[model samples]
Target: MKKILVVCTSGLGTSLAMRLSIERFIRERNLKVKVEHADMGSANFIEADLIIGAKQVISCLSKQNDIETIGLEDIVRRRYIEEQLLNCDTIQTWLKEKEGLR
Candidate 1:
């Protein structure tokens, strides 16, 4: 299973929403993955194969080791949470390619 960390400004509202949507997308696709939500400030506590976040916070987590970062600008849509979640599919593909699992 893949582990993913979702980060946002507050960690409670938009971040949580994105997490749920990702979980649902994984379930619907029958993919094996785990996702955790965190505020940009607590990024150290997160142990993930990949880190997804808004562009505003991506720079902060980009320096971390062993974790891939996906900027939300690459996936975000007009105020729709689902679009953000769907964008993770792109990250998933990138990860697979990087790990030679594709």
Candidate 2:
């Protein structure tokens, strides 16, 4: 399964909430993706195909790692988050590949 990490500065409430939102989206879309949460410091230690967070956080991660990332303007907006997930090319390609497997 493709893995995604939802990151925040402290890895507490905000990250957990974002992870839940992403999980709900994944379940609704029937996507074979694993989602997790981490703090900025811990994120570097975890392995994930993709990382999602506030724009600045993602920017910092992008500079530090080669993983694909999605940066959000509004962290708590479900519609916006879903829209970004739908529009992301990496996610779209993975979805297509999964469809072919089925």
Candidate 3:
């Protein structure tokens, strides 16, 4: 399973909310990915296949080339998250692989 790390400035409420949203999205789509949350300080140290957070936070995470990152303008907007994630090449490829597994 792919790992997703949701980050926020404090590793508190905002990150938890984003993690919840991502978990819901994954569950609804039956995507095989593990989701977790962390603070900005811990993001770089975490081993996640994907790092998702606000644009500002994600920009910092993006510096590392190995992990995929998704920056959202609005952290709690489920529709926006779904739309952006659908447009992500990594997510699209994962979706295709998931479909093939079925």
Candidate 4:
């Protein structure tokens, strides 16, 4: 299963919402995945195959452990959660490409 960690300011509202949306999206497609959430200030407790966060938090996480990050601001808009999930798919593709290159 793919492991994903989502980070946000408080790790409450947006993070929880995104996690649910992503879970549903993957389940519908019968994909195996796990999603975890953490406050941007305290992310060390969780390890992930991918780390996704709001744009404001991306820079802080960029240099941490070589995990791929998907910026939420670039994808979230007009209160739409599906848009963020679409961006997640793009991130997944990028990860696949990187793995292929190796």
TM-score of each: 0.68, 0.90, 0.92, 0.68
How do the residues 1-102 of candidate 2 rate in per-residue lDDT, one tens digit apiece? Answer: 689999999999989998988999899978889999999999988888888998888777635456778999899999899899889877888889879988
**lDDT per residue as tens, model 3, 1-102:** 688889999999999998888898899999889999999998888888878899998877637666778889998888998898889877888899999998
**Comparing 2 and 4 by TM-score, which wins?**
2
**lDDT tens digits, residue span 16-99, model 4:** 777776667666645556888888877766778777777777667646676667767643442354556556654457446656
C-alpha lDDT score of every prediction, in listed order: 0.70, 0.87, 0.87, 0.68
| CA RMSD of all predictions | 4.7, 1.5, 1.3, 5.0
- Predicted structure with the largest TM-score when compared to the true one: 3
lDDT of 3 at 2: 88
lDDT of residue 100 for candidate 1: 75
Q: C-alpha displacement of 9 in model 3, angstroms? A: 0.5
Better of 1 and 4 by lDDT: 1
Clashing pairs in 4: none
What does candidate 1's lDDT look like per residue over 6-65, in tens digits?
898778877777777667766665556788999988976777877777777787764877
- Of 3 and 4, the candidate ahead on lDDT is 3
TM-score for model 3? Answer: 0.92
lDDT against true structure, model 2: 0.87
